[model samples]
Target: FNDGRIQQLAPPEDLYERPENGFVAQFIGENNTLEGTVETIGEGNCTVRLGDGSVIDALPVNVSRAGERTLLSIRPERAEFNLDRLPEGTHTVKAEVLEFIYMGDIFRVRLRIAGNENFVIKCRNAVGQRRLRPGEVIDVGWLPQDCRALEAA
Candidate 1:
């Protein structure tokens, strides 16, 4: 992947949205991953407690048991910023704005969440979007369906 491409024979949407594994998720697009343990798993969703104690409600991509390690993969664009009030069954985590860059077409935000680095939010740079300031401590979230819960390893 350093200089070559990975070819995966997958449906276009699967490659972008529901990747088969971490390899595909990392290879096909920009994705944010978090390490955690499965807190609970029910009918259609799973709860994960991240490394820093942040809990995430995510779509259950694969069936897993409580206390088992898991991974949560979500795209930055799926991670909405301020103004999108955290809804029930959504993930809430504290993050500080490391840097916010306006790149014409979109707003690229660098964040430090729960001590994890390189966490980004590629949001729209439009009229209604929330403009963030560096050093701001804020709550960012995503809907359960927006994030996929996968095996940790």
Candidate 2:
């Protein structure tokens, strides 16, 4: 709860998958938050222009129309760098690999994305997985529904 008030009452899955506001989104888990302005609102989705002038489509959770300030929230694991791991037609942004950590079951990667140096993506340790190196540039993306547009914090 923010400031001692109940922000939302829901199941764990609902809270993680469908947070209601910026506070809950940040409070519950590790989210990559980027400030942006709503550029367009469409059926079930909206486009946001980030501070670095990169446009990304996201699910409109707390935004209404164009020009509304929003905070784009995405989970690290939801962001994929290897295009082969994602479905076709996914939107992508360029990210530079800053650091790659070999976790036991997952590869924790730090990336510079959309002007955020601390942006991170977790790749599962699997057979035939490609190892990323520092200074390598790659395309990173997530499904539109995986990104949530909420009130700017």
- Model 1 residue runs over 4 Å out of place are 1-9, 85-89
lDDT tens readout by residue for model 1, 3-39? 3765456787878988756777887779998888889
Assess every candidate by TM-score: 0.87, 0.95
- lDDT of candidates 1 onward, in order: 0.81, 0.89
What is the per-residue lDDT of model 2 for residues 37-114, given as tens digits with 9 covering 90 to 100?
Answer: 999998899999987687888999978889999988899999998788778977788889999999989999999987
**Candidate 1: minimum summed lDDT over ten consecutive residues — where?**
1-10
Candidate 1's TM-score reads 0.87
Which run of 10 residues does model 2 get worst, by summed lDDT? 82-91
Model 1: lDDT equals 0.81
